[model samples]
Every structure is written in C-alpha cells, then in structure tokens.
Target: MIVSNVSLSGCAGANSALCAAVGDGHQGGGSYRSTLSPTGNLVVAVCLGFIGTFGLLNNLLVLILFCRYKMLRSPINLLLINISISDLLVCVLGTPFSFAASTQGRWLIGEGGCMWYGFANSLFGIVSLISLAVLSYERYSTMVVPTEADASNYRRISQGILLSWLYSLAWTLPPLFGWSKYGPEGPGTTCSVDWTAKTANSISYIICLFLFCLITPFLVIVFCYGKLLCAIRQRKYRKFLAALQYVFGLTE
Candidate 1:
C-alpha cells in the first residue's frame, strides 16, 4: 500500500500539480509559469521531495529483497520486480528534477532535457501500467488454471515484460519524431506531449496513446482482477458445499 500510494501519488500529482499551478497563475486563462510565488514553489518542492524519498526507499528495499533472495526469483516476482523498476525510475529520474523545476519556478533542464524528461516520464508510466496488467493476468492464470501448462508459461510472461518495455519505448518516441511535440505542460513545471494542442497529428497521437497504452492495460487489469475474485469465491463455495455433503452423508 505504501508503494502504491507513493508511486501513484507521485505520478498523478506531478502532472496534476502542473495543471494546478497553471490555473493558479492565470486564474483560469491557463497560461504557463505565472503561478506560484517563490514560497509556494518551495512548498511544492518540499512536498514532492518527501513523496519521492519515501517511494524511493520502499522500492529500493523491495529491489534489495529481490536481489538478495534466490527464493524470490520467480515469474510473478519478476513481474513485480519490473513494476518496481519503473517506480524506482520514476523516483530517481523524474522526481528530483520536478523538485528543482518547481522550486526554481521554471524548467532548468533546457529544451532537450525537457523532451527527454517528458519521454522518460511517459515511458515509465506506461511500463508501470503494462507491468501491472501482466501481473494481474498471471494472478488470474494461477487462480483459475494452475496447471503444468500454466507453469510453462513463465518464460512467455518474462518475454512479455521485455516486450512491454519496448512497446512503451515505441510510443514515447513518436513525439520526438514529430507525431506530436513535447512542450511545457501547465505552468512549465514539467514537460510532456502537448495534449492541449489543436493539431490533427497531436489529436491522433493522443487518441492512440490513450487507447493502446493507457486504456488497454487498465481494462486488462480490472477485468482480470474481477475475474480472479469471482473465481476464488466460487472455489470456496464449492468447498463449502462439499463439506456440507460430507457432514450430512449425502454422497453422489
């Protein structure tokens, strides 16, 4: 839960804070970099720093456990490890710069760094999503189809993790190649693919990214988890019925 809160809050709040800062600056006009006095910016930096530190420590501990224990080396654990990698990257690569930018009241990384940061942020976010969906599917398979055949699928799951990273990378690069462009996102606190742009290419990229990267994995995780819960209940109910029959001497 700590891991989830820290990772998700950092990811969501980082972006949302930019939008919030923008709104604060322009009073609904949505201008950039005019919001937040120096003190406000410092407060934001302090908050982000705390969030990033907590998340980084938790994820690092998990990684340390994974590396330290041979028993922790399994397909499901690998999926979790991959997820941790993404969150850890978010903590290390994304967080401090956000703190610096927030406190400094503008992007200090220049244009190219801004683009890289945007791409990296998008990449890490997508990787985390894909990792979660894959983990959900693994859990579903384990619960409903715990067979030798399913056990053999471990290699494929690991391969899927690798593929997901590549998939995330592929989508993040389109902006660099001009499908859309990375620009100051909301109050200039961070850089990302300019979602508010009115260009056709920008709209197309946004739609595709939403559908493929975000929506697909989200639906997969939700569906798989729901199915998993139902399966467990069904299994337990069957066991309950069997116990009742055995006690009542009603053999079939």
Candidate 2:
C-alpha cells in the first residue's frame, strides 16, 4: 500500500538518515519505506511467485492451443490470442522483476529498470483492456450483422489487434516524454505510474489515463454486451411468439 506521507522524490545515497528512512539505495533512486514488515514482504513475494508461475503457464498454453489448432484461429479468437500475448508478455517481462524486488524488500534494479517495468506493464495492460473492448464489439457485430462476420472479417480483426497495440503505445509513451513519470509504487517493490505525484503534469496524465485507457474501454464493453443481451432476448421472444402462433393456428 502506498502511504501518503512518502515523497515521490528519493534521497541521495550519501544521506544516511534520509536513505534509511526512505528505504534502500536503489541505483535508480530512493523509494518510500514499506509499512509492511519483513513478513508482509515475504507474503507478497510468495503471492507474486505463485501468480507469475501460473500466469506464464496458462498464457503459454493459450498460445500453443492457438498455434496448434487451425480451427481455433477464427477472427474473434484472434482477439483472445492478442490478449494472451499481452498477458504472457506481462508474466515474462513484468512479474519476475517485481517478484525479485519483493524478495529483496526493495527495488533492486536501478531507475531505468523501474521506468522500463512501469512502461512495459502499462503497455501490456492497456493492450489487454483495449483488446477486450474490441472483442466485445466484435461479438456484438457478429450477432447483429452475421453477413459481415465472414472470411473477410479477418481484416477487421487484424485491424483491431493492431489498433489495440497502437492505442496502448499512445498512452504508455507519454510518461517517457515528461507528461507524467513512472516510479516505485506500493511497498517500494513494484514500479508503476507515479500516482503519488500531485503535480499538474502527473495528475493530468493520470486523469487522461483513467479516462481513455480505463473508462472508455469499460463503456465500450458494457455497451456491446448490453446490446448483445438485448438481441438474444429479442430473438428468444420472437421464437416463443412463433411457437404460440403455430399452436393456436393448429387448434383453430
């Protein structure tokens, strides 16, 4: 958990008291001292290890299934593959570093690693979210306009896959350019977008990230799924009405 009292800026290594109070002398910079005791850190490490292991295995299985089974390579399934790829990337590139940091009770990697971690995770995460949103829309489209869901639909799915990555790239790149910054977050073991920074730059980026990357995709998913449910209900209702009419006509 991130404590409000912790500063975004870390003290230099030369300052003994400052360094001790903050946390460890990470090559990247200093970070907040974790409120969690050694036991808590150990628990975190264990959890991360478990999650990382399973995540790697599961996502790898998904990729293998997709590749091995040509029948599973439908347009809609492409989105699933995209999601698995992003998740697998997160497991490979992001999870192990945080796991290591948790084990050491601090971010062992330098500042560059922290920034890279924050960026990579953010990129993969946003891609997954956007891909989900696109998948929802694709389902809705397939139902509402079955004619368009033909072999030609692969182009649309391909575009969606490409756009998800592009959209994620657009959002995650801002921090590297100075719109916001990435740094050590909760417990000083994991790095992420600097949620603690109160500056206009940081706050603005956070707001945009929440609005576009999170809220927009969420709304898309809800709208698509809601329409799908309505369509299904309507189709069922029509079938029921048809059956009733047929029975009445026969009785008459």
Candidate 3:
C-alpha cells in the first residue's frame, strides 16, 4: 500500500508541477541561471563604469581641443569627433544596461527598453563603420592626388557626416517600424538583436553584414591602401636608394 501511494504522489507531482517548475519566477521559459557570478558581476560593472567615464572624458577632450585650438579643427578632426560621440553614446547607454543584465539574470528593462538598446547599438556600430570608410577615402585622396584633396572642405565633410547619420538611421529604423524584431533573449534574457530567428527580417541583418560591414568596407580599405602604397613607394624610391648608398659606403 505504501509503494502504491508513493507512485500516485509521484505521478501527481510530475503532472501538476509547481509554480517554480512552470516559469522559475521569470517571464521566459526554462530555468533562471545567472551567467555571471558575484565577482564577475562586480568586475563587469567596474569595467563598464570605467568605459562610460572614459568615453565622457574623451568626448569632452575632443570638444575642448577643437574649440580652444583653431588648428585642431579640420575635416578629419571633425570626423573623429563624430566617431567619439558615437562611442560616448554606446558607453553611456549600452554598457551599463549590459552590466545590469549580466547581474540580474534577466532583462528588467522590458520590450521598449530592448528596442531602444538594440537601436542605439546598431546605429552607433553602423556610424563607426561609415566613418572609417570616409576617413580611409579622405586619406587616400590626400596622399594620391594632393590637388583633388583640396576640394574636401568643411561643406563636403559636413555632407559626408550627414550621410553617415542617415545610413545609420536606415538600419536602425526597421525595428521601430515592425520590419525587424528586437527583444531580450529567452532562457538567458540578455538584450540584443535576434539574429538567429527564422524570419525575413533576421535575414536582413545578414544582408546588412555583407553590404555595410564586409563588402563595402573591404572594397574601400583595399582600394585606399592600394593607391596609398603605390604613391608612397613612388615618392620614397629615391630616398630609399640614397639610404642604400650610405649603408654600402659605410660597409666599404
């Protein structure tokens, strides 16, 4: 009789389960397991705090250098300032929440917060890439065709900066418009773009990677470096020959 009673109780417990069994006191399914330990959490928090602080300081320094020193304000420096601002935004907005999400073991920020986080992160990342491409082109032009370089004035540079912002906006707006989905991870509950989802929008991210991050930038960098290298080699050949002459004379 005791054996039968035990079997019945076991069946009931397995079938009904407890509230703990159902959701683990969190919104998502699966057990709530923290990816970070106490020490890890503290370390991450401190690191992110440092990043945020440094980003603020770096942006302020750039601003001060540009404003106080007239010579520091150039088209290239302006591009650098914009990149610094993007980094500042990332450090200020993304890193702290990432630290918290690591500790809390779940996303307490909700759906709206998830969208905002993803948008800001994506926007900044795209902007940084575009700025790198622009800088590379500018350098290439400056080195290869000095005459053409003179045309890269503040007006043209400003237009380039505006175009980068618009490109970032194009990538980031999809989530807001319902074309793409942004939310916290299930099981782990960390906020990020849902790249692995079986959706058309998810595929758009892969396309974005190829177009913006890989192919476009690869072509830009390769083209710029190729031209720059040829120019440098041409200009330095005589100097290199003179150095070789001195070395051979000393050997003799």
lDDT of 1 by residue, 16-120 (tens): 544443343334232235256888788889998998999899999999999999888777888888888999999999888878888878666655666778889
Backbone clashes counted, model 3: 0
Q: What's the TM-score of each model vs. the native?
A: 0.83, 0.88, 0.75
RMSD of each: 9.2, 4.7, 9.1
Clashes of each: 1, 2, 0
TM-score quality measure for candidate 1: 0.83
Which rank order by TM-score, best down to worst?
2, 1, 3
Q: Which ten residues in a row have the lowest lDDT in candidate 1?
A: 1-10
lDDT of 3 by residue, 73-103 (tens): 8777788888887887887888777667656
RMSD of 3: 9.1
Candidate 2's error at 63, in angstroms? Answer: 0.8
Point out where model 3 deviates above 4 Å: 1-34, 147-152, 185-190, 241-252
In candidate 1 the C-alpha lDDT for residue 161 amounts to 95
Task: Tell me the spans in candidate 1 whose CA falls farther than 4 Å from its real position.
Answer: 1-34, 147-154
lDDT of 2: 0.83
Error of 3 at 196 (Å): 1.8
What is the lDDT for 33 in model 3? 36
